[model samples]
Target: MSQLLRRGVLVACLALSSLLLPLLPVSTVAAQSGPAVTTDKDVYDFGEPITVSWSDAPGNPKDWVGLYPTFAGPPGGSSGATLWDYLDQGDGQTVTPEGTLTWSQQRPGQRDTWPLAPGEYTIYLLVDDGYEVVASTTIRVTGDTDGPEPPPEDEWPANPSDPALSRKLRAMTFNIWVGGTQVKFGSIVRAVRKARAQVVGVQEPGDNLERLANRLGWKHTFTSDDGYTNLISAYPLSAPKRSDEYAWLRFPGGGRVAVSSVHLTPYPYGPYDLRDGASTDYVLFNEGTHLEEMKSRLEALSALAEAEVPVVLMGDFNVPSHLDWTSATAAARQADGEDFVRPFPWPLSMSLAEAGFRDSFRTAHPDPVQQPGYTWTPGYPPPIGDQPANLTDDEVFDRIDLIYVHGPVRTMSSRVVGESYRNAHIRVRPWGSDHRAVVSNLRVRPLYRR
Candidate 1:
């Protein structure tokens, strides 16, 4: 029994050692975790379903998984709370898993459509194994595409014989908030049509030019390929051009009245580069490149300003009305014959003023006491339990929205609409654009007649 038993035991021990040696590493001995779930699509278009799949593990499988949608502020605080949370539960359509571990889950099906408004949504999948959530990358649901076509050109009333009546044109510059469903095309269309603005300058259009123009029955011209900022008017556009800083539309009204729509380069006070930077204040007062671009554009625009045709420029300038201490000190230092630190004061507004332009709002209503208007602010009440003091203090109390006249134009009245301090009961949500529309009545004396 000695040699035979010994050889049998040695064989058994060697076999056991082979198995146990591989399992000695703590990393290898641990049981395999849940399956790795991945989604084929990062973004889901409206009326389209997303299919998700997983890498199967070599073990007993779990049956169920859960999905949740969450939201967050944009990179630069552009957005507030997650809008998806407010969506009705009925809006979320889901599919239950048919089989266990090794199976794929197709949401809605290939033909099924997810009817969600345009936004950035994330879908989270939690496997029944109690493992951490397997998340699909953020999916952006962009607005539905109707075909693209050139905006319609419409006719305008003939110039009046009376000089006083003919020169008078009512203009409105509005910053339509395109971030959400709050102030949509329907509301804006109704407002613009009712206002009957001869020429409307709009900001933050958000690629909805076609929808907006069609809804309002007005013609539009956009600055970018993506159509972020646009000009919608009853008059025909001559030639439209854009730079890094601004977009200009040449409106041929007798003589050429060039309308410049600007979205200035944001101030570079924040930490990150513009490409990936996030900030509480994304409103740039001066972009170095944008400043040069605007300067060049303004020089070009000055040529269009003839004695006969007046150029009226208006939009969100993203700069303060007057020079601050930083600018004042820099100017003084330069005058003293010393190399001074370059001042980045709200240069755009000041540049326009230097280029023989006048601010119409200041001209019309000289006193700030009479019309204390602040345009940019979070339109809703502060979140529950938050202080009203905090709310009031957080408002962008500066006057960045301005209407400027370059050549021969007189401002009869320029005031911010819908600002009533005495009546705290007024709701700004109905007229809920981020900017208060700066409306002005300009008197343009015809160059030929004058």
Candidate 2:
């Protein structure tokens, strides 16, 4: 009788234990049947946004998923001070009700959007109420890395390029990608001629500024051996004073206007050059550091603006103006789509503004909410030309190519010039460059008492 009773109790206990197993933590119950988590790409550009996908993830309060710095440590997330990029003390993230991590799950950390520097890192989905990681994958962070408001009823000028104004100077800034090799060169020449601007500046002008100026019947001055940037004037330009980074030109007839065509550090160094080091500043909050680290550069340009002649500085400034980074534009872009990047004031512009240079485009188009006036990329999807697709779907179409003026300058109009498929600007045949030209008509006086 005693033996039979003991056997019955053992059987009952076994049955109860099997029933209780289903109620334990999810990590103990589910076996990872597929890829636990993975990024779409193995190697990412310096600031590239990643798409991390996973087959299953639980939305429980005791679980979480995050990307952590692995350094030269273990990939299993087992043996290091795994610094999670997020400050999430919450239960779950990047997990769906249907048990999947979507493209949108590749979100940046809240504290530092640019979390990863150029190095190796790992992603982990954890379950010890936040201590033990159940699944993990690795990713690489290769590189480093606007507007406005308004409650006003905007009144746009019909003839924004007001011709009636005297002392008006028209200036055009062109990156002329690869010295205008990307597009038919003749088209660029024709476009410049058609604009009839007194001042023209080109970035990456290559070793052909003199010939190109001759072809356009414009006087040019860029004595530097680097030949990366050139300053041309319909009015004769006194030989440029050269620097390792820029060229200074003088237009005595055009009210003693001093001009400089500068090509600042292009990527991994320029202001706001995060994530692809080109058109991707909006999403990252850390872009200001690049500009902050380059204060000496800002002062040098400021000194030029304060020089004897009123300055009309132009080039692929490689930095956007502060006008595009107001609280108003941020609110507007919040609903633009999942891919839209959040923009910061890109500190270089702030530096220039503080130094007294006026952004001709912003001066003319005061309402950034109304006139974004993007000068990079033809438009989203690049509707025409041999235009290439953007590095990312969320790539920012910014106005980095700029023309800034100082010393009592008034902007009458500023318009972007290029292929007019979507922008409706005057159409140029066989688009001549990757960057559309920034042409601004301004009324100004010479501060130089020559």
Candidate 3:
């Protein structure tokens, strides 16, 4: 009995030792093998230098680190680096596995003075001069100074008004889907008020135009016979003799302008067809019909365009702008699912441009790469239709709703008003509509008849 007891004790001790093996010191095991990066501080005072440390990196000469403002788009070279430094300090020599580098606005090797501004920024350890980030960390710089800090790098200068242009106007194009029946109407009212838009061109009013205008206390409202398009304004709007597409808007100071609200056919949307790998010829063929529809609406206003009468056309065009579909936008597949639909000369916008109309949002923001203002469905109430089963709930995002300006109107400041600041240039909570709204601060010059 004693011999059996001793044998059992030995067996239990061996089992216990095996169970405790993993709990031993980490030094007894191999270190984790992969690139790792961290900043000495997560937050810093304005103008303070930043120190980033890294370890277990590939150590290639091209392996580098970049500091980018969070609003500067993705980490790739598309936005360009605010500050960058290679592990070898651009000496074309390999570097050690781990080290530290500091940047205080002026990049190490460059002579130009690129001061690190106060804002949220990210640090990335990338390899081979590419966007393949081995590791990354985020840091914020607080504006601790007494005076106010400047706007972010992406912010457009506030209404760079041309000296000759003085009559100020704020206009908006909103498509309150199905009269915003899905959400509370007060939210829509709040959205318009938040935009501070004096003149609004509305689509899908759906018997709610009067209610909306009454709620906002706007004096004038125009609704198409078919209820497809509508207009509401603080200024007086004279109904044209026999037109549903446009109305004469008279400002308090005697400036006269024409405003049009149009909702183009949503059937056979060009962006989705393009995404389905449809040929350019097919897409343009469909757009040709859209072009005809647009021609019919603007035909009566042709002389107005020629006469340099300021006309603001706002609507859900149901198509992306030609200016947005460029080579720079093509380089980045937005959010991974969207296809590269660039260099596409969308005929509708091209026709509008030929008629001397400029996209108000694009006029305010010239760089498509810097700001791809996607005002289409804001990734809510996912697309539902006879779509392919393989298609995800949220697929494509493009700027389909638009505000176009003709004649003497100058788009001063333009921004997208949507559910959140992440999705729009301005945030109007309880966004109410699936499609975001485009609002522009415009300066309209008075038209003097010859």
Per-residue lDDT for 121-141 in model 3, tens only? 778888877788888889987
Model 1 lDDT, residue 343, Cα? 35
Task: Choose the strongest candidate by lDDT.
Answer: 3
TM-score of each: 0.49, 0.57, 0.60
Better of 1 and 3 by lDDT: 3
Please identify which of the two predictions, 1 or 2, would achieve the higher lDDT against the true structure. 2
Best-matching candidate per TM-score: 3
Q: Considering TM-score, where higher is better, how would the candidates rank from best to worst?
A: 3, 2, 1
What's the true lDDT of residue 443 in model 3? 82
- What's the lDDT of the predicted structure labeled candidate 3? 0.74
- List where candidate 2 sits over 4 angstroms from the true fold: 1-166, 225-228, 239-255, 269-297, 338-340, 379-392, 447-450
Model 2 C-alpha lDDT per residue in residues 249-357, reported as the tens digit of each score: 4445534656666665443322223322334333223345445534554565566555534567787765666578556776776667422334454556766765677
- How high a TM-score does candidate 1 get? 0.49
Ranking by lDDT: 3, 2, 1
